[model samples]
Each structure stands twice: as C-alpha cells, then as structure tokens.
Target: MIDKFVPSVATALAGVKDGATILVGGFGAVGQPDLLIEGLIEQGAGDLTVVANNAGYGRVGLARLLAAGRVRRLVCSYPRIPGSVIFEDLYRAGRLELELVPQGTLAERLRAAGAGIPAFFTPTGAGTRLVDGKETRRIGTRDYVLEHALHGDVALIEAWQADRWGNLTYRGSSRNFNPVMATAAELTIAQVYHAAPLGALDPEAIVTPGIYVDRIVHHPAGALHA
Candidate 1:
C-alpha cells in the first residue's frame, strides 16, 4: 500500500519531464485539485501543455500555473475572462501557446485516447472556421472531420474520497472531469480530501476504479473555496 500511496506531490510527479502534455481534471473551482496544482507550482515544472475544461477559477486552478509561468500551451474551451488573467493573454503576449477545442469534442478526444482508438471522425466542427485547414473525409453521404485522440504523460485529478489502493470518489461537479481523466493519461495522480484503506470505499460509490490510478495524495484539509 505504501507503493500505491505517495505522501508528497513532488514524489508523485517525479517521473514527469518538462514539455510534457498533461490532462488536468476539473469543471471549475469546485473540483479543481488545488493541492496538486500548488505542488506543481512549487515543483517549477515548465513548458507544459494543459488539457482542461476551463483555464481556472480566479487563482486556484490553472491561473496559479499561469502565474508561475509553468504552462506553455493550453487546450480548453473558454479562452478569455473578464478582468482575469487567462491563457489567451499569455498566448497573445507570446508567452503561451493555445489550441481552443470545442468542449464536447475535447472530452471526446480524451475518451478516445483512453479507449485506445487513435482517431475518430466527428461532425462537431464541420463547415466552420474550426475546420479551416483540417482533413475532411466523407462517410456514406455525410462529411466528418477526423480528430485525434488526446493522451497525456500525466493526468491530474481531484476526488472527494480516495482509498489507499487509489480508488476515487468525486463529489458533485468534481465528478465531471476526474473519471474520464483517470484513463486518459499514462500516469494518473489523484488528490483527495479523504484517504482511506482499500475496502473503505463502497464499490458503488467509486467513480474511478483503482486500476486506472497510479498515485493518491491526500490533502486532509477537505474541499477548498475559491
């Protein structure tokens, strides 16, 4: 069990290298893994490519990474925020790189990676500015553009409860991105407010199976407010 539960975030991220793509699981501030994010900031991991639902909520989410200049590229839905430091500003100022993908399509890409399907066709962004230079193939009578699956070197996930075996349970909105991201990366690092032994979590309550997780880190402080 000691091998499965890493005490510190730095050790959990020891194998992660610079310029690696990373999938960050969160819907907003609610499910954002603040502890792990703070650890990454202190770790000084730079030139990162982040895949998440949003840039961040105020300063707790991706914004913290941005402030630290650790992230170089971002693949997300929303680009700008009113009076907030966003990924676009960093990109526009030649400090960051960005690829804005449609939210649904982005989720599908990660799912495809976890499912081991290399590339799939979708009509999500057809005949629009998004399809400007992409390859288009026709299936039967309809046109579908191919989007490749997205996989990352590391996936950062947050959970409401996690067992020592790495089984994870997310509460409410936090559940949105944790389960999918668990399978979307080569190494999954989870942050939980409550960490217990292997059998402590009810089977039905587990959102992410332990098999998909590689490390579990507990914050103990419980959920954090934005």
Candidate 2:
C-alpha cells in the first residue's frame, strides 16, 4: 500500500531538520497552510530558509513563524505590507535575511526546479540591482539575466481534498503556489480538508498527483485562521 496519511500534524512534519529550505505555498493568506505552520512552530525546527510569495500578514501563518524566530532567511516578492510588522522589525534589526525576487521570477525558479531545468534566462531583472552579481546577457534587443532553479527540502501546502495515496486538490484561490511548491520540494507535506477514499476524487480534478507528495494531514477548512 502507498498510503501517506499521518494521524497528526507532527507526524506529517517529522524529519524536518534545522537549516532546511522550506517552500511555503500560498498567496498571502488565501492558500496558506496555517495549521501546519502552527504545528511547525511546536515542532521547533530553526534556521529555515522560506520561499514564499510574501513575508506574511498580521500575526498568523508565516508571520507567526517569523515571530517565533525559526526562519533564518526569507525569499519572496514582497517582504513588507501593511500588517507585516514582524518581518519589518526583524529585517530592520538585521536579525533576518531577505532575498527579494520578482513575483514572476520566483514562480519560474520553483517551476524550473521541478521541471529539472538547471537555469534559465529572464528579462525581468536585467540592468537592475536584482541582477547585481548575477550573469546577464542580451539576446536580440532585450537583456536577460541568468536565474537558477529554486528547490526546497520541504514543502508545506494546503489541499482541499486528498486520499490515503496523497493525491490532492485545491479550493478556489487557495490553489496558488501549492501545486508548484509540491513539485519543487524533496518532501511535500499536504494539509488536506477532506480525506477521501481511493478513487473518490474525479481523476481529472486532481491537481497534484500522489507521487510528488510524501505526507498528508487532514485539517478541515474551518479549523484555524481567519
């Protein structure tokens, strides 16, 4: 049997060591997996390099992780927003490191890692501080910079439904970044709302196949966060 369901969040997060790169799936709070993040806080792994769309909002989800001082570095498009005080404070004090990548560039990097593409050229950051020490070249009239694929040791994502086999689906806007992060990580952990039996999900509705997932936890939609 290829069952990957775990009884609790702790079991799903097992073996995540210190200094690991974590691919966090979500666009702001929409698809963000807060229960897993809360569990990770208790799991107590530190010095994490998190790849996400933004720093975090308010004091939940990624913000909570940052406040817990578990993150060593953050790689994202937006490191600051209205309610992102924790990231702002830590970054200003120089207690945290930030890698600011453009939104499109960030997504492509994760996608490239999953697709086995070592590196690629993009015109997004040419002739700017974003490409400061990185290689740049001009093809035709537009300039491009060499961007390497971004891979993760672990990925924490939220799925709307799953089976014991770990195949996944997403709900509405929560699907953002989850699918790509699942493919880009060495170990993908999914927090699912529904634990369906085998063959319960419509085959065409499965967004992430079971082969890419390593663990699954059932955390219902109304369980945590706003």
Candidate 3:
C-alpha cells in the first residue's frame, strides 16, 4: 500500500504553483482545512482560482487566502457572507473574478468531474443569465442548460479522522463538500484531527476512499472549531 502521509502541511502542499485552480472544501468555516489554508498562505503562490461553497467570512480559512490577495477568481455558490469585506472590496474594484454557481449544481459539477463525465445538462439555470451563450436542450416540457464539470489542480479538505492509507471519516456538517472535492482534484490533500493506523477505521464509516486522496497531514488538536 502507498503511504500517503506527509510530514507537514508545507510538505503536503509543496508543489502547488501559481495560476492553479484549487478546490477548497468547506461550508463557511465548518469543513474548511484551516492548517492547509495557513500553509498555502505561507506558500505564497498567487493568482489562484478557488472553488468552495461560500466565500469565507472572517480572518480564517479561505478568508485569509483572499485577504492575502492570493486568489484571483472565486468559483462558488455563495460569495457573500456577513464579514466578507475582502472579497467584496476586491470584487467591486474588478480585481477579482467570480463564477457564481447554484449550490446543488456546484455539487453535481464536482461530482461529474470526479466521475469523469465531461458535462451534464440541468434545468437549474434555463432561461436565465446563468445559461447565457450555453447550449440548452428541451427535454419533455422543460429546457436544460449544459454545465461543465469542475476539476481542480489541488483540493484542500478537512476530515475528522483518517487512516495512514488516507481513508477519511468526517464529523457532522464538516462532511459537506469535502468528500466530493476529494475526488475532483489532481492532488487531494486532507488535514485530519486524528490519524489512525491502517485498518483502524471501519470500512463502512469511510466517506472518502484512500484512492482519491494523495496526501494526509495530521492537524493539531482543537485546530478545528468542531
């Protein structure tokens, strides 16, 4: 078996380069990989396109990345949050780009990428600006817009526990986007609160299988907000 564990966050994210598309798994701060975000901030690679559920709220997680001016574009469902002043200012000034996707569509796009399906049709954005210039097909009585799959160069995700083989188990709402994002990236790195020995995790409890994950970094206890 391949040992997917990495010594540190920096090591886990070592090869990340500028202008790379990154998938950040989180719903606000719930499933955000804090330590990995910190490492990326320290890595200082700029001009990033980030995909997530929402723009981060405060000075944590994706917020920190945005504040550092490393992100060039944001591809997410909800870009506005209570304290997302950084994103608001940059966006208003045209310094940042935004691709607003509907929540369910975003999830399905990532899932489609992981499943190797290039594009899929959905009625979610038919007849709206979201479907502008995109192909639309009439199915039954409704029109469906073609939405392309979303894939990333790197995926930073957080999990409750992981085995040495990189099998992951999430806690509560933290499971939101982490699992799907794991499968949709070229390099998937997971930050976990606990690291169990191989085979310690129950097979049925694994939300993300080790095959999709490339690396695992054990985050310090209490790093996650719970």
Give the runs in model 3 whose Cα sits over 4 Å from its true position: 223-226
Tens digit per residue, CA lDDT, model 3, 124-165: 989999768999999999999999999999999999899888
* CA lDDT, candidate 1, residue 75: 87
Per-residue C-alpha lDDT of model 2 across residues 148-213, encoded as one tens digit per residue: 999999999999999999899898999989999999999999998899999999999999999999
Best by lDDT: 2
For model 3, the run of ten residues with the poorest summed lDDT: 217-226
The local distance difference test score of model 1 is: 0.81
RMSD per candidate (Å) reads 2.4, 1.6, 1.8
**Model 2: residues >4 Å from true position, as ranges?**
224-226
Q: Of the pair 2 and 3, which is ahead by lDDT?
A: 2
**Deviation in angstroms for 113 in model 3?**
0.5
Displacement of residue 146 (Cα, Å) in model 2 is 0.5
The whole-model lDDT of each prediction reads: 0.81, 0.93, 0.92
- Highest TM-score, which number? 2
Candidate 2 positional error at 47, Å? 0.9
Backbone clash tally (model 3): 0
